[model samples]
Target: MKLLYTTLLVVVYIIPAINAAQCLSGQYPPKPERLLPTYVVNLDAPPVERWQDLASKYKVELKDLIAYLKTFLVEISPELQYLVDLVDTKLPAMADTLPAPYGDEMKGISQASGLPLGEVVLYNIFYEVSSLCTSIVGQDEKGNIFHGRNLDFGGLMGWDKINHTWALTEKLRPLMVQINYTKNGQVLFKTTTFLGYIGSLTGVKPGVFSVTINERNIVKGGYIGLIEWMYNINRNQSFITFAIRDMLTNSESYNQTVKYLAEVPLVAPCFYIVAGTKPGEGAIITRSRKGSDDVKLLGRDDLWFLAQTNYDNWKKQPFFDDRLTPCIKCMQEKGKNQVTFESLYNVLSSRPMFNKETVYTSIMEPATGRIEAYWQLCLDEEAPCRPW
Candidate 1:
C-alpha cells in the first residue's frame, strides 16, 4: 500500500517544478525536480583565478550570502568587535593555517565578484562552525554501496528568540551548486555546495568513495569555542569540509579514507559518513575536536546499514530532538529487498527525518559513481509537511 502510494505520488508530480507539492504522505515529498547547477574547476588554473568565472555567474548569490552570513555570524559574536575586527584585517593573515587552494579560491571569488574579502572569508566557513544533518550508508544484497543525506542548517536570531527560519533556506535554494574539481580534463572529485563556499558537507569521487558530514553536537552553545577556534591560528585544526576535500583529493581506497578521517584534527566536532564501491567500504567516523572518538563501519557483524544524525551512536539522544531512531527504523523497513537508491531516498525523505530545516537531499551509489541531489522545497505545503 505504501509503495503504491509513493509510486502514484511520483507519477502525479512528474511535471517539472520548482515548488511543487508532491507528498508521499503528509510529510515525505519525494524527488523534487529542482536541479542545482554544476560547474567544473580547472585544477591546472591558478587557485586564486579558478573561481573567477563562477563569481561572475553568481554575482548576486556571492553578494547576498556574504551579507546574510555577516549578520548571522555577528549576532553571536563574543565581543562583536573581535569578530568584526578579525574579518576586516586578519583574513589575509590566515594563509599559513587555512590550506593552500581554499584561501586562494575565496580570494578569486572576492576579486571577481568585487565583494569584500572579509565577509567572503567568513561565508565559506559557515558550516565549519555549525550545521545539523542526517546520513545513511548501506550495502545491497548484490554488495553495491549506497549513501544518502539531508543537510539542515538553521540559526536565525530573532529579537526575542533564535529560531529555524525558512526564509533563509528558501533564499538558499538558488545558491545550490555542484563543483567538479578537475585536472587535465579528468574530474578528481565533486562537491554539492553553495556557489561561493569552497568546503562541502557532501561530496563524491567516482569509483573511489563518497562522503558526507553531519554536525555532531557534543557540547551545547559552543559558539564561543567556535569563535576562538576559527581565529586561533596556532590550533592547527582542520576545517571539517576541507578535511573531506583533502581525503577525496588524496585517498585511493576506503581503508585509507577511514584512517584519514579518524586521524585528522578537526576544528569542530562532526559525524563523517563514508561509503565506497566495495561491499564493506562504509563507516561513520565519529570525531572530536582533536581526535576520533569512534569509527563505526557498515557490513560489520551483519550490521548492513548505519544511520547518523546530530548525536553519537553510543549516547542516548534527547527525546525532544531524536531523528536517529526513526531514520534507522525507516531504512530497515524500506531497505529490505534490495538497497536501491530509491529505498535510501525513501528513508531519508520520511517524516521527522525530513524536517522543516532540511535544505537538500542527496542519494549516492558509489559503485557506478552515480549521485543525485534535489532541493527540498518548503513552500505553501500542508502543515507539518512544509520545511517552514
Candidate 2:
C-alpha cells in the first residue's frame, strides 16, 4: 500500500511538470539571428574599375553597397587613424563651443540639424568625407556607394526616404530657433521653437500672416528681418487667406503643410510689421519705431481697415510684372503716399477684396487691426469681405 501511494504521487507531479515545461517552451520563441550578406573581392586586381563595372552590370542594393564600403574602410583603417589624429589636433581651435558629452552633444546636434541624433553621430564618425567624395558616391533610387576621399569608410547607406537626403546633410542646417527675452539680464522668455517660424510662415495658405508670441524670449534686434521676409512672401491676400485657414484647421504634419497649402488660392496681399514692447508695457512698438504714441496695440482696429483697403487696391491695380526685382517696385510706388494708418485704410476700403489696389504705399507702415481683422474674417467664412 505504501509503494502504491508513492508511485501515484510521483506520477501526478511528473505529469504536471512535463505539461508546464511544454507550455513554457511554447510561450517563448527563440530569437532570430541577424543575417547580413558578405561580398568577396579580389585584392590582386585594380579595384576602381572593378567597382565601376559591377555597379554598371548589376542593380546593387543599398545594403550590399554599404557592406562593401565597410570592408573597404577596414582595409584602410590605419590611414584613417592618422587623419583622425590630425583632425583631433586641429578641430579644437576652430570650434567655438566646447565638446559636449557623447550623448548630450549628439542630442544637441540632432536638435540643431533636425536629424536623428544617433544617425548623425554615426555619420560624423564613419562617413565624414569631402563634397568630392559625396559626388563620387553616386546616388541611385535605391542607395548610394562610394570610395574613400577623406577616409575609407566614407560611404553611407540607408538615406532617409522622407527627407530624401543623408541624415548628416539634414544636420547641417539649424532645426530650431532659440529666442531669449530678458529684462535687464533677468530672463523672461527663453524658449525654442522647432524649425522656428519657417514652418508656420510657409505652411500656412501662402499669403496669410499669423503672429505667435514666444513669451519666453524677446528678440530686441532680429525682428526687422523676419518682418521683411514675411512681407515679401505674403503680399497676396488670397495666399494669406489660405495660409490662415490651414494653420488654424489643418492636422497634417509640418512637412506636409506646404503640400496642403499648395492647392489653395493665393488671394489677399499681406506683410509682416513687427513691434516689441518693454518687459512691463502692454503697448506694441514697431521695429521701425514710426508708430504714434497713442497707437500702442500692435494690431488695432485702424490697422485692420488699412490692410483690407490695401488688399482691395492691390487687387484692382495691374499685377506688378517685375518678378526679378527684390522689392515689387510698382507695389511700393502705389504705397508711397499712404504711410499713415488712416490713409492706407481710406485707399483700400473703396474696392472689393478681389479688386486690385489702384494705389500703393511706397513707405512701409505698421500692421495693426488688419492682421487680426483678417483672422476674424477667416473665422467667419460668411463675412461679406471673405473672398471666394
Candidate 3:
C-alpha cells in the first residue's frame, strides 16, 4: 500500500509535468484496429438468461473484467467494506425486487460468466458513483442535432491494478460494448456501455434523441445516499441511469423524452444532456433527486450548442469540474456551422476534453440514427502522463 501511494504521487505530480505540453494536444492513440461488438440483448429471453449469448461469446473477457473489479472492491474496502460486503450478498434479491431488468440481467451475467452474483452487482453499481464525463450537444447548418461525450471512470488508486501492466481504464477499453436492446424483432434503443451492466449512462433512441449522464457534483451525502437507497431496495425507487434506459425504450419524440428525463425520480443527482433530431432540440437537464434543478435549452436565437462537464450549468467556475469552461470555449471556436459528427468528435477528442481518465468516446446523430462508439487511449504523443 505504501508503494502504491508513492506511485500515485509520482503519477499525479511528476508525470503530468513531463507530459505537460502534450496533455490534451488533440493527440489520440491510434484508433484500435477493431471496435468491440454490439451485444444484441433479446427482450424475449427471460431476463435471467438474456445475457447468456454474450457470456458464451466473451467468457474470457468477462473473467478478466471480474478480476479487475475485485481489485477495486479490495482497495476501497477499508472504509466502505462493511456496507459493500453486506450489500454484496443482497444484490441478487435486490435485482428481484427492482422493477427493471437490472437485477435479472446481472443475475444472468453472473450465471453465464460463472462468477459470484454479489461481485457482479457491485460492478454494476460502482461506476454510478465514480464516473466523470463530458457531454456536448449541438445543431448543424442542416438542422441535424449531434450528441457526443467521453465516459471517464477509474479510481486513481486502483488504476494500475492489472499486474501493474495497464490502468483500469485500459483494461476497460476492450470491455466496451454497444448494446442494442431488441424487443420482438426490432431494435428499441442502444447504449454505449460496458458488457455486463444493463443501465445506460450514454444511449440513443434512433431518430428520436440521444442522452448522456455526467456525475453530478455533490455538496454532501450523494454517494452514500445512493448506496443506502440501493441497500434498502424498493420497487418505487429508480436509478437515474436505469431511468435513462427506460426513457430511450419508451419515449417517442424529442420533446416527450425531455419531459420524462426532467421529471423522473432518481436516487442521486446527475446531469442529463439530450439532443433531438430537429433544429432546436437540445437541452442540459441538471437534476436533483426528485426532478430537475435546472433545464437549459438551445435556440436562445443562435445558441447552437451546450456543453456539460459534471457541474450545474448555472454555477460560475466550478471548483473540481475544470473541463466545463474549456469545453465551451472549444465548441464556440468550432462554431455551430461545423457541428457535424466528425467535427464534434474532434472537439471531444482534443486535449482537456480527451484526458487520461477517458475510457471511450461516443458520437451520435438522432437524425439518421448514426452512432459511433470507440474505445479510447492517450498515447505518449498525447499524454506522457497516461499511467497505463
Candidate 4:
C-alpha cells in the first residue's frame, strides 16, 4: 500500500510538468478560445466597402491593395484568418511599409519604392506607424491587456518592439541629415566645377551657372548657410544672378540664399565680426548703447578676431589681444565707440568660452568698401574706459 501511494504521487507531478512544457512550447491541445481579445474581433467586413475605401483613401488600385493588405495581415497573425479578412475589408491598402507586426511585408514595398531596404523599413516603422501606435495606446484604457487596436497578438508584439526601436532611430535623424547634406553639397560642387571645366574646354563662356535648392536636398539651418557661402565664392556674379532669379521666383532656397549680398571685402569681415557674437549678444549690445547705462556682464573669455595679415605669427595664438587692442586704440582716437564697447562687453559677458578646437563656419559674399567704426571702448576689468 505504501509503495503504491508513492507511485501515484510521482505520476501526478510528472504529468503536470509535461503539460506545462507543452503549454510553453505551444504544442498543447488547442485552446483557441483562450487566445487574446484580438482573436474575437471580426477581421472580415464587406469586401466591396473595403476595396472602395482602400482605393479612395489610400489611392492604391484595388488588386494591389488587397494583395499587400493580405500579406501584411498574414505576417502579423497567421492563425487569425477572420482578423485578416476584417483588415482587408476595413483598412485601406498600405501604400507604405509598416513597422513591427507588419514589417515582414516591407521587403516588397521597399523594392517597389526604389528606396533603400533599410530606409523604407525605417520610414514605415519609426516615422509613420510608431506615431500612429503611440496615439492609439495613449487612448487605450489603463488596465487594458489588449494594448493596441486594429492589431492581433503578433501585431501588438510588433508595435511594442517597434516603439523601442524608434526611440533609438529618431535620435539619429538629425545627425543623419547633417551627414547627408554635407556629402551631397560636396558632390554638387564637384559636378558644377566639372561642367565649368567642360565649358572652358569647348571655348564657350560658361552660361549662367544655376543651382537648384530644395529642402529635401539641403541640410537645415547652419549647413544651408555654409552651402550658400561656397556657391557664392566659387561661382561669382553669374551664380549670384542665378540665385537672385531663383529668389525672385520664390524658390525654396530664396529666403536663405537672398539674404546674402555682395558688398566687397567688407561684407565678409562684417559677417565674421557679427557671426563671432552670439545672436542675443548683438541685441544686448544694442540695448546697452548708451554709456550711462548700467549693464550686467557675464565673464566669458572666448572673444578672438581672425588675424588676416599675420596668419603664420597668429596661427598658434588666440587673437583676443590683437583684436581688442585696435578697438581700444580706436576708442581712444575718437571718444569711446559706445556701441562697439557695449557689443563686445555683452558678448564677453553672455557667451561661454568655446573650446579652441571648436570650428566656426559662415558664408558671406565679399564686396569692396569699408565702414566707419560705430563705437569703441577700452575693456577694463573693473569699468568700461575711454580716453577723453
Candidate 5:
C-alpha cells in the first residue's frame, strides 16, 4: 500500500513535467513562400562612390520599393505628411544629432538608391514609423547573451501580407541586404537591413554586443498626454535603432551598452535587449518616450532569462501570455545543460512562443565573435531547425 501511494505521487509530478517539456517541440509552422536575402556592403569607401556602387547593384529594386512605401503613406498620408514636413523643416538640426558616419551613410543610401534625402530620412525611422515587433533576450548555459524576435508589420506598401509569403521572393529578397561597415579608422558593424536604409533595426558588432529594439505600446494617458506627445516632437533625439547603432560604435562592454541605451533621448517609447559578451551582462531595458529618467532595466539580477514579446516588463502586457510559462520553463531546463548555439535556437523554435510572424531570427555568442541568423521565416521547413 505504501509503495503504491509513493508511485502515484511521483506520477502526478512527472506527468506535468513531461507536458511542459513537450511544448518545446510544438508543431512546426508551414514554410514562408521565400527566404530572406542576405548580402554585404562596405561603406569604408568614399561616400559617393560607395553608395553609387549599391545603387548600381540594386537600383531597380530600390526604386520600386520606395514607390511601394509611398503608396502605404497614402493611408495615413495626412498625419505622416505633417510629420515629414516637420522633419524637413528640422532636417539640419536632426541630422546633427546623429553621429557623422550615419550622415555619410544616409547620403550614400539616398544617392545610390535614387531615393530623395527626405525619403531616406523617413526610411531610417521605419520601426517607429511602422507598427510592431517583439524582442527577447536570454543567456545560454554557457552564459552567452542571445536575443531573438519576430518582426511583425503591415506588409510593405499594399502587397497584403507579402513580407511573409514566398510570393515576394523576387521583389523583396533583392532589397534585403546585410551591410558590413568597416571604415579604415572605425569599428566594424554588420546589420541585416533592407536596401537603402541606414539604421540598425537588428544587427551585431562582435565583441561589442548584439542588440535589437521594439516599440512600447503607447500609454493610455488622458487626451492631454496624447496632445503633448504630438506637439513635443524632438527630432534632435536619437531614433531607437539608430541609437543602438551609435552604441555599437562606441560602447565596449555590456554595462556600457546599457548605460548608453538608457541615457540616449529617443523619438518614441521603446524597448531594447542588449546581450553582452560577459556573463551576467545582458539586459532588457524599457524607457518612456519621455527619455532617460524614465529608463528601467530588467536584467540577470531580476531573472537569469528574459523574453520580451511586445510587452513592457512593468505591466507585463499580455500579447503572448500563454506562451510565456512554457517558454520560461524550457529555457530554464536548457540552461541546466551544456547550452550550445542549438539550445538557443531551440528556444526560438519552440512553438509556444516562436511567433508565426517571425521574419528573422538571430543567435549570437558575442564573446567568441560567433553569430548565426535565418530570415524570411523559412527555418520551419529545415529538417533539423538548428542554427545555420
Candidate 6:
C-alpha cells in the first residue's frame, strides 16, 4: 500500500513537473522562410464590421496572438500593473482622441477578437510603448531615394514558450496585412503590417512618401504625469502609428508629410525616417515626448545616402547606437556609388546588422511607390528572390 501511494504521487506530480519543464525549456525552431502569408484587407465597411470580419476570419489565432503579445508586455513593462493602469485610465481618453473612424475600428477589433477594448488599445500602442529598430533614407546613384530598415525587438526572449507552443499547436504562420482605407473615398494610402494589428510602423503612400520609426528612450526626462501625457497625444487627432496611417492617407506630397510629421504630437520621443519622391524632400524628423516646439528636423539635399540608427545624430551627442557604425560602413563599402535595390538588400541582410532577432526587412522606392519585403530572416526562404 505504501509503495503504491508513492508511485501514484510520482506519477501525478513529478512527471508532470518534468514535462512542463521540458515544454518551457524547449528550443525554438528556425523560422520558416515566411512568418505569415500575405493578405489584403479592405476597410470599406463600418469600422466595427470591418474589424469583425477580420476577427472572424482569423478567430483561430486570436487567443494565442493575445497571449504572445502579453508575454512581451509582461517582460518589458515596468510591471503588469503599470500597463493595467494605462489601460484603465489613459486608454479611454486616447481612444476618444482618435478620429472617429479609427476609434470605431478599435472597438471592432476588440469585439471580434473577444479582447477587452483596453487590451486592443494597449496592443495598438505596443511599439510606441516599447520598441527597437534602425532605418536608412538616402539616394542611390540613379537618384533613386529608398527607405530601408530592420525591425529589431525582443524575439527569442523567454516569450518563446508562448510563441513556440502556440505556433506548433496551431501550425501558426505570420501574415502581412495590406490595409486599404475608405475614409475619404478611394484614398491612395495603404500600409503593410502584421495581422490583428492596426497601426503603421513601416509604410508608404504612393507618389507621396515613405516613413519608418526608431525608438528614443526618455530616461533623462524623468517620469511624466498621466494627465500631461494624454494632453500631448495628438497634433491632428492621431496617436503613434495612427498618425503615420493618417499622414499616408491624407498627405499628398513630401513637404506635406514633413509638415505633418513635424507638427505631430507623441507620447514618446522617437526617430523618424521620411523619404520623398522629389529631390531634397527626404529627411529625418526627431520627435520629443513633450510637444512640437521641441521637435527637430534634418535632411540632406546632396548625399549618396542618408540614414539613422538608434541614436540622435541631430543632437551631435556623445552617444551612438552600437549598430550605427556597421550600418554606415556596410552602405559605404558595399553600397557606395553602386547603391541599387539589390545592394540595399545585401546590406540589410549582411553581417553585424542582421541577426536572429530581425523580424522583417523592407526597402521602399518612394519615387515609384514600390516596396520589396523579406519576412523572417532567421527562416529566410527568400520568398522575394528578386528586387526591383
Winning candidate number (lDDT): 3
Q: TM-score, each model? A: 0.85, 0.17, 0.87, 0.15, 0.73, 0.75
- Residue 338 of model 4: what lDDT? 24
For residues 1-388, what per-residue lDDT tens digits would candidate 6 score against the true structure?
Answer: 4345435534643343321211011112224454334444455666667667766677557656556666545544344446556765677566666666677778887788787777677666666655567687767555667788776655322323333211211222354454554453654655556666777888878777999877765563212323344566334333567678777767878888887777765655677778888655577777775454333333333456766765665545222124565667767675546556566666666533454356667778887777766664432242211100
Candidate topping TM-score: 3
Q: For model 1, give the 10-residue run with minimal summed lDDT.
A: 14-23
Task: Point out where model 1 deviates above 4 Å.
Answer: 1-32, 74-81, 95-97, 157-165, 220-235, 383-388
In order, candidate lDDTs are 0.72, 0.23, 0.73, 0.20, 0.56, 0.59
lDDT of 3 by residue, 204-245 (tens): 888888999998866642455456665674334567788888
In the range 300-350, model 2's lDDT, one tens digit per residue, is 432211121111112342122111121222223334332333332222222
Model 5 CA RMSD to the hidden true structure, in angstroms: 10.5
Which has the better TM-score: candidate 1, or candidate 2?
1
Candidate 2 residue runs with Cα over 4 Å from true position = 1-87, 95-174, 181-183, 186-326, 330-334, 337-388
TM-score of predicted structure 2: 0.17
Which 10-residue window of candidate 4 scores lowest in summed lDDT?
195-204
Error of 2 at 5 (Å): 89
Per-residue CA lDDT of model 5 for 275-299, tens digit only, reads: 7776676677776655543444435
Ranking 1 against 2 by lDDT, winner: 1
Candidate 4, superposed: residue stretches over 4 Å from native: 1-178, 182-388
Cα shift from native, residue 217, model 4 (Å) = 27
Model 3 quality (TM-score): 0.87
Best first by lDDT, ranked: 3, 1, 6, 5, 2, 4
Any runs in candidate 5 off by more than 4 Å, and if so which? 1-43, 74-78, 81-99, 155-173, 185-187, 220-235, 292-302, 319-326, 333-335, 352-356, 378-388
In candidate 6, stretches whose alpha carbon ends up further than 4 angstroms from where it belongs are 1-36, 71-74, 85-94, 155-175, 180-187, 220-238, 291-302, 314-321, 379-388
